[model samples]
Structures are given as C-alpha cells and as structure tokens.
Target: MADAGYVLPDEELAQLQKLSSDFEPETTGPLVGERQSSAAITTEYANADPVYRVKTAALPSKYAYFRTCRGDGHCGWRAIAFTYLEALVREANVGKFEEEEARLMSINNLFNNVGINYELIIDFAEEMFDLLHKLAHSVSSNDGNADAILLQAFNDMGTSLSIITYIKFLASAWVQAHPADFEAFITTGDVKTYCSLSIEPSQCELDYVAVGALSAALIKPAGFAFEIMYLDRSAGEEVNATVFSQPTDQNGMLLPNPPTIRLLYRPGHYDILYKAEDFPPPVQQQPIQVALANPYNDSFIPSESSVDIMAMIPGMYSTSFGHRWPSVPYEFDASPTPQAQVTPVQPYTPTPASAAPVNTSRQDYMPVHASHQPNHSNTGRHGLHLEGPPVTLPIHSLPPPPVSIERGHLTLERGGPFRPSMYELEQINVPSFQTSIFKNSQYNTAHYMNPDFQPEAWSPDTEYGAGHKGKHKPPAQ
Candidate 1:
C-alpha cells in the first residue's frame, strides 16, 4: 500500500482513475423482476440530478409499468429476449409460440451460413426452445400462469445464460447476413471480424448494431414492434424513444397497434417498459353455470313418505323455490394437485317468474333435525283435503346425502364451503312466532318461521328408555 504522505505522478494517477471508473461490481437480484408501477422510477430519482428527475417524473404518465433487468453486462440482450417472450404471452395465442419456435429453428441455417458451428449453439438453442414449449402449454391449458413461468425461467442462472448466448449468436448471424445495412455502424468495417470480437462474445454488452439485427430477425416477423427509450442527461422533459422495427404486412403496409416490446435504456444498462394498454383487462369470472340434466321422468315415482306430492307439483303449492345455486369446480393451480376452491356461499333470492324448478328432495334441501311439523291447515287451497296434524317422515324414506368424490387425493377439511340448504335460507312470508325471549335466539330451531326449521319427531327409543328406567331388572327376572 502507498504511504499516506506519498504523492503519485500525473500519468500513473490518470491510469489508476481510468481503471477504477471502468470496473463494475457483479450484478445481483433476479435476471428479470416482477412488473411494478413505473412511479417507482420517479421515486428512485427523487434526489438525483434535475434532468433525471424531470424525465422520470413524466415517465409513469405514459409508461404505466417497468420491470427491472439485472445490471450485468448482458442486460440489454436479456431485456429484449425476456420482453419478446412476454409480448407473445400478452398475445395469449398458442399458435404464436409454435410459429416463433419454427422461425428460430430456421435461423440455424443463417448461423451455418455465417460459419457459426451448429454444435456450439445447439445446447443453448435447446434451452430457448424448451421455454417456448412450456409457455405454449401454459397458454393452451388456459392456466393464466405464463407470466410466472417466464419470470422463473429467466431467473434460473443456467437457463438464462444459455438463452442470452443463443440470442447473441443470432444477432451476430443477422449482422453478417446484411452487411450493407449495418456496415456503416460497425467501427471495424469488417463485418465478420467485428461480430467475432464483439457481437458474438459471451461477456460483451449488446450494442446499437446488434439490437437492430434482433429487431429485424426476431421481433418484426413475430408481429411485434420494438422500441428503446433512452433516459439520460439529454435535453428533454421525457425520455426519448427510437423505434427499430414496426410490424408490416406482406404488401409492406404498416400494421397498426402491434404488440410492443419496449426497453428503458440507461447509459450502460437496460430495463423493460410498458404502457397501461399493454395488459388486457382482468377477466371477471362469471359464476360457473352448471346446466342441470332433464327433469325426472313419470316412471320414476317418489316414495309414499316423501314431501306431499302436491309440493312437488309447481304452482300447486305457495313454496318459493330458490335460485339455481352455482357450484364452482375446484380451481387448479400451478401445482400438480389442484388447490381446492373455497368460494363463499352467496345468498340468492328466488326469482318467482322466470326461475326454473329445482328438486326439493335433494339432500341439500332436507332439514337435518326434526322439531317443527309441516303446515296442514289449508281448507280448499290446491284441491287438497285437510288431514290431521302432519306426521314425521320415517328416517328410512329420506334419500342419502350427496357424495362429493374428488378425483385426486385431496382431503377436504371442515373449512371447505357447502351450499346453503333450503332450510338454511331466510323464510319469507312465513308466520313469525317471535316472543321477546325467542327473538334472534339460536335455540329457536323448532319455530316454523326459523331459517333452520326442522319438523318435530317422536323417537321410540327415547320414549321406552325413559318410561321403563326403574323396572328393567324386575322385568328380566
């Protein structure tokens, strides 16, 4: 170490300062991060220079979101690669993924023409193709998980490096193919030599020439526009954008409003940019309407002990049938086993005029406990003879509870939702026997107006046990 008192010469001091300025620390964080509101960019520059503060302040008004790319030397290439796949995902078309894979496969010939060895790039190309396959499956399955899958694949160091290398080679091959278009930008003038030394190297950052090549070779043909917004000390209130490619039709007519892959370019780093219009509105899930099968046939007769046949005959009884209850199928997640959907039971009002008839005999409609008996005082209504007090239906006559047999090994816990039974909903227009003591009482299940009304029953076992309690021994003897 140099002594504190020692003074360095001007030439040596200049060399040391240059080395220090050129050195960059190793990058950290995910290669690509989650998409976040671009207001974060403005906040990041709150204490920064006036130019940066002014530019970033106007950023969120136009670009609603920004995603970070790691500041490693390959960020430019990584940004473009990631955004290209993301744009395809935004398209939400399974066919587009296949089309892109085939187009990239054909580009192998370009590599061959440019003297890039097939074996050298095959491993990297395979990684790229594998991601394409996974994304295609996600779209076709309607999993709505392409965003998560794409983010994870890019975060994997091995997969990310392989894909970055693959694109670097692609850019190199594209540049070599069209010398006239890019030769002027190449300082070395020799296209082959420039690509070998700079464009195709694994550690080199992406440059203007390579970005243009990628735009033409990969993005434009995939029906996407390519743009880069330069945020710098440049004289502007907003960041300046340069459009490298705009998708066009076969007739060379410009296509309007194509999916775009935008990048926010700093002096030596690159991140992704997006407008509010980039994302489609979230799909509002309508309740899953399960169309029930046909009504029971005449041959299928109800047992003698079932609810009076008059109640089953629509318009004969004044009972109001509730709405068609929506039963939601379990929502399958990214995991192999579908996580159970725990939908809250919504109270449905029974529409009298247009509502279809629902089977009241289904177990979900049956009352569990027997306490309150059915009303039987109608004199001439519905052409029924007034019978003695309604009797309790026998337990054997009740249908079995509906069985929900899940396909996989998912063990449903008690927290899982169940449809609210007919007896569980509010009983409207029914006579209320509310006294001051019984008002809002949980123990009022016996009341006819109770939401959980149950028909009263006499149990033979309880009666015999109570009457013969003390005489049992003498009887046995």
Candidate 2:
C-alpha cells in the first residue's frame, strides 16, 4: 500500500532508471572550429546578464579574432596543443621546429627521472613528433597551407587525443621531477601520487598545476610566451589575464615582441585568441608577361629584328641620306590592264636585281594586292600608266639638288651584297612630272617603292630669298 502519491511498479522504475543512465547531453560544432571575428562572442551574450554583456562587448577591441574548441573535457589541453603548433606555424621557421623536436626528445630524461616507462608513452610521443615533422616540411617549402594543416591535424580525434596525452605525460613528469616547487600546492603531500591521480588520468581535464608545469617544461624554453585570459561572470568590466611564460635571452632580459600563444578561458573550456598584428596581410600576386612564339611564318623577320640586323650592316642606314622616308599613304592605280599607252619604255635594271628577286620571292606569304606588285613589275621603272586622276604624294621636305654628273660615270657604293641601280643616278635639271600617270608613282622620292627613298626637304631661305624669282615672271614688267 503506497502513500498518497502513486508509486511506480518495480519493472517501470527499473526502465526509467536505465533511460536516465543512458542519456548524454547533445554536443555540436567541430572539434576545433575555424578562426572568426571575436565580435561573435559579444553577439552570443547580447541578451545575457549585464556582466557577461559588458565583458564580451569589450573583447573584440583588443583581441580581433578567436577560434573555438569543442567543449568536451579535453578542450583546454586541445586548445594549448593547437595554439603551440599554431605559434610555430606563424613563426614559419623550420629550424625552430627541429630544435623544438630535439628539445622535446631531450626531455625524455624528465620522464625517466620520474620512473615513467618509455614503452607506455612512445605511441603518444610519436604522434607529436610526426606532426612536428609535417608542419616543418610545410613551412620550409612555403606551401601556403600550413595553417590548414595545423587545423586539420587538431580536428582529427585520434591525432588530437594522442597529442593531448603526450603533453599530459610531459606535465605529469615535470611536476614529479620538480617535487619541491609543486609539493606545497599538492594537498596529498606526495608529488608522484598527486600526478598519478590528477595529471596522468585520461578522464581529468587540465588543471592549474599542469598548466604551470607545461609552461616550464615545454613553452618557456622554446622562446615563446603563453597567456590565458579568463572570461567569467565576475564583477570586472573585462576578462582577467594570466601569463604563464615570457621569453627571454641568455642574460634573462625580456625579448621584444616575441611570438605569443594566447588562449581564451571561459570556466572549463579554452579557445585561441589573436591580435590584429599576429600576421601580415595577404599579398596580391603580380601578373607575369610571357613572350609568345610567332606562328604565322618562320622566314618572315620581325620589324625589331630587322632594325637590329640592319643597324649591324654598314651604310644600310646612312646619315649622308638626308631624310628618312615618311610613312606615306599608298594611292596607286588598281587597273590590272590599262589600254592607255605611251612610247615603249626601256626597262631600268639594277646591278643588284638578282638578290631583290630572291628576297621578294620568299615574301610570297605576304598579302599581295593586284595593283601593288612587290614581286615583279613590267610597265616601267616608275610604275604603270593608268587613266585615273593625278594623286599627289605628300612631300614633307625638299629634295637635294641633283649634280649634272654623267650617268655612265656615276657609281653608287652600298654595303653588303646590294649593288647600284642605273635609274638611281641623279636625273639633273629634269622638269617636274605632275601628269596624272606619274602622280603617287614610284618616281616620288617619298614613296616606299624606291629602294633608297628619302623625303624632300623644305628650304625657307631659298623660298623667301630677295633675289629669287618665279619661273613665269609677271609679263616681263
């Protein structure tokens, strides 16, 4: 007979007890979350108590960013482990990682001094060393993925657990070896006994004594500073800071702005923290200019290459040649067969005509217009006669006065394999040919059709001379 309240039957009570025992609190997020702005912390406590709101609001001003660690029992250890490798990564010094591995190996003596068996801790120790080697390789090669490697390594439960266990062993060994320092803090009055129960146990979270021991044994010797900022519902407007180590030189003087490992501690859990200056801003890569291979024709020479080659040949380009041919517009007759005819003109030939044919023949790949024949010409040296209106070749300068020398006695000397042309002899006292047939023809010195083309030069003195008179004076007045 039960009392006033109804009592459950024995089978029902057993089932309820089993259900309660089997229940576990649901946990979410990655093992170690991505680094993000610390402002999120302020937003998370926006509707919370006034003390939390004030503290979190001020957090981002000093510490620009933070990274979360899952709040399992191992968060504190995992956070410190993650941040240690991270600080090494930020340094980006391969030699330092090797030195750290060596230093850690040397501390195996500490484990031996405390009577800890090597066999028991070798698997855990190997994981830490392998990670060190991997990070060192990444930093040395400048793969630009060292941070991602570190994040992934810590996120892996097996690797993360092994690393945490290794550090735990180190903390325990350091405490036991330094009994005099930690003996007073241990309530059990035995250093080894306290470490066995508190530090070495797989289930126990990292305690204050272990943090101090790890700071002494691992971090301070490596020239890195470690800090933990406590965030809690205390009376202060901001979280409190506790520095475990400060790097110093051989003289015990503090080093200036050495790399620091900072952790944000909120009661039982820990996360990583960073100031704005922890890393340099990403650099934008400049585009590289590549020289593409010319694919149109192998025999065709580039303009620049031609200029360079011509410069090397003597007299190919000469100062004696007064003016260079200005780039003139071509307005030649397009008529293929013009019925218009004048007296049968004799063909003008150059002593260098043989080489010209070879050069022109190789340039067959060039676009050829029917009106402008680069390969061969049949009508005359000046060009063919057509019925179109006269096209004036714009003359920028006056031509040099021709000396009335004998055509037979004239001898033009040029460099290389080229010889003189008979038509190139100066045509002295020849009347100006302004006919429709000769306009824009090769006869013009400014035209590219002439091999030794030179622009005509203007003489202001001759044009405005006091003694100068026009060809047709005004009625002999």
Candidate 3:
C-alpha cells in the first residue's frame, strides 16, 4: 500500500468524510473575532521570509486590524460573504435596512434566472440570507442579538457553509451569464465543467475570474468597492495587491475610497481587512503608460525588458461582466446594457525603422501618434511625463506599470490603475515577428543578458526635448 501510486481527488475526499462541515481543520479560532494587530502575524514570518514579513508589516499600517478566515480552502468565499454580512450589521446598527432588504430578496432571482434551481441550493442560501435579513431586520424587530447571532451563524457549519455555497453559485451564474467576458480564460473550452469543478464546490480555491465575479455580485447593489491585497511570494520586495475596483473614468483613475472594502490574500487563503486612521496615506502614483505606435523611427531595438512587459499584457478587461449589470443574471435580462468598453491608451503600434529611437543600446524610445495620450494620475504633483511628446520610454527601462513603490503602497500619480488583469502588448492581427526583432533575431535562448548593466534615471522632459526625434540619447554618465 505504501508503494502504490495514488492521487486522491479533493472533492471526493470532502464528500466521503463530510469535511467542509467546519472551517479548515488548521484554521485558527471562531468565525469572527476581535481584530488583531497585523504585526502579530507578520512578526512570525519576518525572520524566515523577509518578503512576506515586509509585506505583512505594511498591512497593519494600512489596515490597523484584520479578521482571519480559516485557510481551509473556503476562505475566499467566507471572506467576501462575511464582510458583506458585517457591512449589513453596521447598517442595522444605525437603523438602515430598507434598501438592503429589497436587494437581498432580489438576488434570489439571479439564482433561478441563471438556470439554477433554488431548491438545490436553498438550504445554504436561506440560512445565509436569514442571518443577513436579521441584520437589517433588527431595525424593525429590534433584535439586539444581531452581532451575537451573526457570529454564531458564521461559526455554525451548516449556515456558514451554505452562505459560502451560495457565493459559489453566484460565481457560476456569473460565468453562465457572460460567456464572452471570461470565455477566453476558460481553457478546455468548457465553462460549465470549469465552474462545477473549479468554482461551484466547497473548498475550491478561487481564481481571478471567480474573485471578479464574486466581488461584482457582492458589491453591485451596494455600490461599494472590493479591493484584494495580494500577499504572495511574487517577484517583488512587497506583496502585490489588486482591487476588484469599480469602473474607471477614461483616464483609468479610480474614484477615492468610494466605500472600498479590502481583503488580504496569503497564497491560497483570504481574510478580511479593515482600515484605520493611523496609516500614512500612500504618496503619488507612478508614471502611466499607454499604447502609442511611433511610425516615425524604425531603427530602434526593443529591449528584453519589453518582452517581459509584453508577456504581462492581456486582452481587454472590464470591472464586471455583462456591462456592469448589478448582480442579476444578465443572460435572462431582456436587454443588457451597452458594454462600457475600456479604451486602452496603449494606442501605439510601431511603424518601420523610422518609428524607433536610435541605436542607443537599450534605449529604444517609441514616438507614437499624436492621439497617443497617456493617462494623467493626480498623484504626480510634477505633471505627467507625457506633457510634451507622444513618446513612451522603453517599457522595461521604466519602473513597473500601474504601481511604483516610493512610500508605502503608492499608485502612480500619473495614473494609478487598480485593474485586476493585464495583457500582452500587441496590435490587431500584427504578425509575431513584426512586433519584435528578437522573434527571428540571431540570438538564442541560452544567452544571458542583463539590461540593468547601467540602470540610469530617465526624465522625458530632459531626455526627449521638443525636437529630439531619431536622436537616441544614452544614459547620463
């Protein structure tokens, strides 16, 4: 038996032992408890993994406290659903549930409209909503035990798991509703199987689309933002955080706060995050980049860094699927709203040799079209680097896009994008080789090259004056 090869399906294991009946086995204490200083947890990881420690240290500064969700694979579902209920509690505490009540009941229709029978998921949905209704209903019923009851319900295996199940249902319906929005991401070409196996089950770890769908469903009726702070061992000095942010204006800058709720993600787990007054407000954002193809110079060489940036580029993105339709199942709607298409400013497509910067080693500036407007974030007290020209610095030469670190978690003052996904940079139907010379270059995969050999500071104003075209300026010595 010890020598036999075996792979136990996690789903089957759950059914056999009835495991998801409680929070993850290793999960710490009760469903909801008093918030603790994040440093308590961060300090534990500090010595062993500096990356996680430094990232975790910033957590307490931003969110004075956090509420943990048992890491038993259901944390994502519990984290969002729990926060939504707590939000309702606060509303009830202040005697405000009229609107919430109507919204709660209305969401039931989404379950049915998406072709899911309510009876199948009724037990869980009912238990979850009953506690939620009580949160708002306490105003009229005057139930003083709202907090106690809510906590008990969350801790209870039956009700807690039910609500989590409903969250998964909503995610499934979301996929069913907008096949186009998430279709490409669905490999194996089977959305239903993917949802059933990956999303709509207990203990299933959520992926990007699931997070997007779940956050959208939770926030739609309430008009709130759901931000997730990613705490992984990603390649960065600090943790990478993204938001299930609301749709942005043309410039891609999100409205301030907007009643935003934060979630902390640690690899496979998620927890609730709360903000306090003591944390320092993040300083200005980093410079924003947009698509603008310089048809002027074609002799410039694309750096290897651009290749990495290219890989990060993803197709079009949206805050919520089905044109931001509030939680309802869009598939059954009589008429869906028009798509709020994201007008990507990455407007540049390279032209021939004339469109490139000179042979200045790693500095191949791309002078894009006049309409190549980069987003202007308010963080830059020093105006956008794009004030004068339609030129873009080498994607690699510049700091990371959308986010640049200066103080704490700084969003680019030039353009702070809280977007959830990024795509590769390519024009419509452009042949692969045309985009980069390296695709067919004499270079092989074995060679190692370091672009940071002489990492120089760049200033668009000083580097690219009004008439500095085709003249590639080397880094300042």
Off by over 4 Å in 1: 1-24, 283-477
Using all chains and alpha carbons, the TM-scores for the candidates as numbered come to 0.56, 0.55, 0.50
Cα-based lDDT at residue 232, candidate 3? 81
Candidate 3: stretches off by over 4 Å: 1-28, 92-96, 139-145, 247-256, 277-477
**Model 2 Cα lDDT, one tens digit per residue, 430-464:** 43222111112232212223322211111112322
Candidate 3 Cα deviation (angstroms), residue 168:
1.2
lDDT of 1: 0.58
Cα shift from native, residue 326, model 1 (Å): 40
> RMSD to the native, candidate 3?
20.5
lDDT on C-alpha atoms for all candidate structures: 0.58, 0.57, 0.47
Q: After superposition, which runs of candidate 2 have C-alpha atoms over 4 Å from their true positions?
A: 1-24, 283-477
RMSD of each: 23.7, 32.1, 20.5
lDDT of 1 at 166: 92
